[model samples]
Target: MRYHACRIAVSLSLALPLAGCATGVKSQLEVRPWHSINEFRDQRFADVADPWEGFNLGMYRFNYYLDKYLLIPVVNGYEFVTPTFVQHRVSGIFNNLGEVRNLTNSLLQLKGGESATTLGRFLTNTIIGLGGMFDPATRFGLDRHDQDFGKTLGYWGAGSGPYLVLPFFGPSSVRDTGGLAVDTGITYGIYTALDPFADTGHSFAISAGVASLEAVDMRHQQSFRYYESGYPFEYYMVRFLYHEKREIETGKAPTAN
Candidate 1:
């Protein structure tokens, strides 16, 4: 009886771990069967730590459809309505506004020189560039410095919790997503406060429209299309590249592996 019991225990130990695997993240660790269903859904038990792969896949499909039917059409309409010069000016204005977030993040990362430069860019563009409709700062020596709260968090040693496929935003990790929220809120507040509209509601409405236009412009800046990678492991590849980018931004050198 003792010999049979030992054999059975060994079998269960090996088999149990293999019973619950991630849908696509290919985690080496298996979900513990003893845990509740909710635990498995949220717990990180694998290499990629994407416990919500099924939900992510569904969101990805939804985003793709939204992009195909809605976002792209709206962006194209924006392009058609505006002349190239106006579009460039709009892009510049958005870039100029983004400097506030960059400045704050630069200070957080302790890059005093970059923070100074970001402030310079903002002031110069707002004045000479005609409220950021042009980029006179770049014509001189001060180039645009792009920083974000996400990079700040990574610089401080916060691990990217898990890979996520955000609707319309594409690949992002938990840390970066939170960073995006903070940055957006900061910018929205700044714009609303500075908006010429006396009414808070009108200022908010204007800022929200500008923010939507900025999002469309930003999306159009990237040319990559879904499933165009020509490989079966496209999702895995995006997750790897994104993490690598975050690592570089945070001054972490990626291993040769």
Candidate 2:
């Protein structure tokens, strides 16, 4: 039970940043006095203890395993399989999924029959469109967008309530956290792998793969910053930057700096 809870926490933590930003941006745009959520989040920040040491330890352990097992063996295997490509195709695939998500959100906000039809089409395409391997919504000239019940509630004029950093889930506004449960429930076909354990296995693999890729990229892009501020700050910065970027993409107001 503890292990399951930890996994759930970690999964929610990673997912919240990706999905939360879009919803949060939508909420900011549709609502007023946006500081309500920010204020709540800020208050929680006071209670937030830095966990850089623990995160660093975990990263170190995970990276060692990745280097010794996954990267050394599988990455090399991929090179032999696709010698022309220097980077893994997984990144491209994930990017394509992002494009699909953006397109879906844009269409949803428009609320037009044509857009609705396209949403269905794109969903189909992503699920069965690119051999179920890639999503091409962005490539088709549609702008990316995102929405969630939290954003929907804000659009309907609900308050953002408070900000909270869940033990494993990191940063979230109280309203947004509530919406996460709804989003998870409504999102279907996301875990429909063939094997009973396939979803679990896939989730773990993707998490580890993304972490490894991030570590390598961060080593090159922000090694100095990582060394200077330590891991917790680095993690928060990453989340902040990610949310800010999503706001920019969706044409929504960002949290005040």
Q: Which numbered prediction scores highest in lDDT against the true structure?
A: 1
| Residue-by-residue lDDT tens digits, candidate 2, 186-232 | 43334343223555658667756665664443232222222233223
Which lDDT values do the candidates have, in the order given? 0.73, 0.45
lDDT by residue (tens digit), candidate 1, 140-203 = 8998777999889988998888888888887777998999898888876876577666666676
Kindly report which residue pairs in candidate 1 clash with one another.
Answer: none
Off by over 4 Å in 1: 1-47, 199-201, 255-257
The per-prediction CA RMSD against the true structure, in angstroms, equals 13.2, 14.6
Off by over 4 Å in 2: 1-88, 91-110, 113-135, 188-257
